[model samples]
Target: MKIAVDAMGGDYAPEEVVLGAIEAVKSYSLDVVLVGDTNKIKEVLNRYGAKDNSHLSIVHASQVIDMGEHPAQAIRKKKDASIVVATQLVKDGACDAVVAPGSTGAAVTAALLGLGRIKGIERPCIATPIPSKKGITVLLDSGANANSKPKHLVEGAIMGSHYAKYILGVDKPTVGLLNIGEEASKGNELAQATYPLLEKLKTISFYGNVEGRDIPKGTVDVVVCDGFVGNVILKFGEGMAMFIIRLVKDTIKSSGFIAKLGALAVYPALRTLKKRLDFTEYGGAPLLGVDGSFIICHGSSKAKAIKNAIRVAGELAQQDVVGHIRKSIEEEEVEQYDSEN
Candidate 1:
């Protein structure tokens, strides 16, 4: 499948992005269309020995939308920008998915305005995969929408559940509502109203309420929350992951001789922990409820992260995630929102 990548949209720009796209094409045998300044992209590709890759093609765009620019306004003005052109590839059916390690706000705006939303999906939830005790948990509405109603929370749950089952390959994924308490009567008006809505969905394996502390425990396969709360939880999880890594590094350095030997003995365990804690391990978050699969990678992502983002794009294409979500949302009569102003 062909995936469109915004080559100019990142902190590292064409250099790192182009190299990552090359790696993806070489490793996955998937066709890639790099949207950016053609000469610059080719220059990077040649450096990586990927300039002659038959599966790769460069689509030239003159302008690049800056990270600070308003998403809607910039997309309109910068018609030939990497982000706009790359997203158009998906909208025009020239590519199966779009991947970018750019401004999260801009990516969200492009997906909403360019590709449109599914009929029954009010808001397109950002599904951020977090490592859990069991495996991984899908957190929905992770900074997509800061404010939402009870219906929106329930919609997020359904989307998160489907994502876990299809993408994460979890059988009968359990849904958890992130809340103040585990009790059913807990949470604000939104959570209280959503509690019953979640119960009505036969397709989802509802697991009742889950607190913030339960996230790392893998209390459930999917955690649902409004964008405002979900964003806070996502940032907190990321921050804690970094903190734990630093602590491990310090512990390894300060240990005595015997303790250093012990550290060596547990080196394998530490490696495993590091991999789990790495945000790039999950590749990127999929912008669910959009017409096509659009992945949002971390702004600070490096070559490895970009490569993995392509894999994520291809996998979503293979699974037809957008189609599945559309069908599920329609069948369940889920309430959707107008993403455009």
Candidate 2:
């Protein structure tokens, strides 16, 4: 499969993105259409001795959307921005998928405007994979629509379940609605209203209500919530992981020689743990409910994260994730949910 990558849309810009695309082409045996300023992209391509690689090509997009800019405004004004152009390639069918390792807002906006939403989907959501004790838990609406209604959360649950099945290889993924209590009567109006709708669905395995702790424990395969709550959980978890890693390092350095020697004994295990906690290992989050495949990586992602994100884009394209989600929406179960409208 071929993928479009935003070469000028990350914190490291063309350098990290270009290198990652080059590595992804070699590693995944996929064609890459690098969208950005041609000269800037080529400089990195040539510097890495991949100037004539057959699997790689360039598409010029003169503009870029900065992280601080308004997503919808910048997308409309900067029509030729790198992220927009890359997403356009997917929309136009020149590329099978789009990978954006840049501003999440810009990436989401570009997908919504360029790719449009799938049939029966009111809002497209981000389905992010988080590491857990049992395995990975899929969280939806991570940063898509901050203020979502019950219907939106229902749609996200359907999309998230299909994503876990097709991409994550879960046969019948169990889905949970995030709330204050496990009882169906608990939570605000949204959760209370959504619980019954999710329970009535035959397409997915609904796991009642799940509290915050259930997420890290992997109590369910998928967690559906509003983007506001999901985004807060994501950021807080990331911050906590980094803080713990730093604390361990600082304590090790400040300890005595005996402690240092003891630490050497567990260095291998510690290294393994670090790799598991690394966001790069998870690749990136998939923006579901859109018409096409799009993967959004961390803005600070370097070479490894970008490469994996490209791989994820290819896998989603190969699996026809968008097709599966559309089919799920068209199923009789989803029609029942829509009957309320």
Candidate 3:
């Protein structure tokens, strides 16, 4: 499969992005098209002894969407921006998927505008995989749309379920609504309204309401929430993970000589724990409900993160995630229509 990479999207644009593309090409045996300034991308490739690889190629994009720029305006004004060009590749069927470690807004906007939305999808939501004690919990609307309706959350649940099933390999993944309380009567109007809709979905295994504490416990396989709440939870969880890691390291360093000797004994386990908590390990989140597969990585992503993102894009394409989502939504619509009549 051919995947397009936005080499100018993230903080370490061109350098780390190019390196990651090379790693993906070697590891996955897939062709990679790096979109960015041709001269700079080539220089970076040559620096890392990555030139002359038959699997790697470059597509020149004259402009770049800065992290701070307005997403919609940038996409409209900079028609030749790397992010837009990479997404366009997917739209034109030149590539199976597009992977970018750029501004979330820009990536989402470019994908929505370039590829359009799936037929039955109202708005595409970002489905991010969060590491939990039980396994990986998929969180939807993790900053895709700041405000969403009850129907939107229902769609998120449906889409998120398929994502958890296909990408995370969860069979019959249980879905839950992120809310203030576990009771059906809890939460705001939107949550209350969405609760019944989710409960009625035969396509997914609904687990009812789930509180914030349940997220780390992995009480449910999928958590559906509006972008406002989901984004806050995502950011807060990331911060807490970092803080805990730092606290453990500082405590270990300040301990006595005997304690230092004990540290070596547990170092391997600690390293494993760190890897499990690292966001880079999962690569990136997929913007579900879009016409084409688009994996959005962290803006600070390095080579490893970018490589993983490409792998995710490849998996989504091979698995035909978009197709499954369309079928699921259509089934739900049919059921609704029959019941109404």
Candidate 4:
């Protein structure tokens, strides 16, 4: 299977994007198509001594959609932009999956308007795998569809549960609705409305309401929230992790001689803990409910993160996650309707 990457769309632009494409090509046996300005991408590849371009190829895209541009309008006007072209590749069957760290809005719009969604899906949700004390939790609507409805939250739960099981290999992944309290009647209108729908989904292991505190504890496998709330939680978790790491470093530096010895003693454990908390370790977020796998990595992602994103794109494609989710939702719908009668 082939994965197409937009190599001109991130904060690092051609440099990090090209380096990442090359790293993915060298590390995996899979074919990679780098979509961007041919000459600039080649220059970056040459910088990394990536001369053997057997597994790597480039598709020229002259224009670039700025991060702030209107997604739908820009996608239509700038037909040759890397993100648009990479998305078209998936539509045209040139690649099994697509990766873009460029404009999140543009990418989501391009996929929805271009490749379209799976049948029966109202909107595609952004699902990000977050590291937690229990291991990992799949958080949906992480940064897409900020304003959502009760049905949207229920859909996110279904998609997130499938993602946790299929990609993360968690069997019968327990689902939770992110709320202010674990109690059944704790949330506002949206959560209250979505609660019954989720509880009735026989295919999923619904665990009722889960608060923000339950996330890092990994008390549930899948956490469902509107994009607005999910995005806030994800960003807050990232910021807190960074702050704690910095604080730990400062504490160790200011510690007394004996305390410093204790810090050194647990240095290895601390390093492992720090790595587990790093958001980069999750690679990227997938745009679920799309016709094909589309992963969005961080705008500032370097070669390693890009490489991981490509791997994620490949794995999702190989597993046929979109097809599985579509089938699961359809089956659940039939079951629910039948039981109502």
Best by lDDT: 3
As for candidate 2, its clashing pairs are: none
**CA lDDT of every candidate:** 0.86, 0.90, 0.91, 0.85
Cα error, candidate 3, residue 40 (Å): 0.8
**TM-score of each candidate?**
0.94, 0.96, 0.96, 0.93
**Candidate 4 per-residue C-alpha lDDT over 113-191 given as tens digits, one digit per residue, 9 for 90 to 100:** 7789887677689998889888898888998887777777777888888888888999889999988887888888888
lDDT of 3 at 99: 96
lDDT of 4: 0.85
For residues 1-341, could you state the per-residue lDDT of candidate 1 as single tens digits?
A: 99999999889988888888888887996899999999999899988888888899999999887878887788877778888889999999999999978889888988888899988877788999988788788888899898887777777887788788888898789999888998889989888888888888877889999988778889999999889888888888889887887898688879778888888888788888888788777888999888898999888778888999999899998888887877778777775432231
**Candidate 3 segments whose C-alpha is farther than 4 A from its true place:** 334-341
Residues 1-341 of candidate 2 have per-residue lDDT tens digits of 99999999879999999999999999987999999999999999999999999999999999999989998899999999999999999988999999998889899889999999998888899999998998899998898988888878888999999889988899999999999998999998888888988887778899999999999899999999999999999999888988997888779868989888878886787788888877667889999989999999988989889899999899999999899888878883454445233
Q: Which ten residues in a row have the lowest lDDT in candidate 4?
A: 332-341
Q: Name the weakest run of 10 consecutive residues (lDDT summed) in model 1.
A: 332-341
Which scores better on lDDT, 2 or 3? 3
Stretches of candidate 4 above 4 Å error? 260-271, 334-341
lDDT for 325 (candidate 4): 83
What is the TM-score of candidate 1? Answer: 0.94
lDDT of 3 by residue, 79-187 (tens): 9999999999999999999998979999999999999998778879999999998989999999999878887887899999999999999989999999999899999
Q: List runs of model 1 lying over 4 Å from the truth.
A: 261-271, 336-341
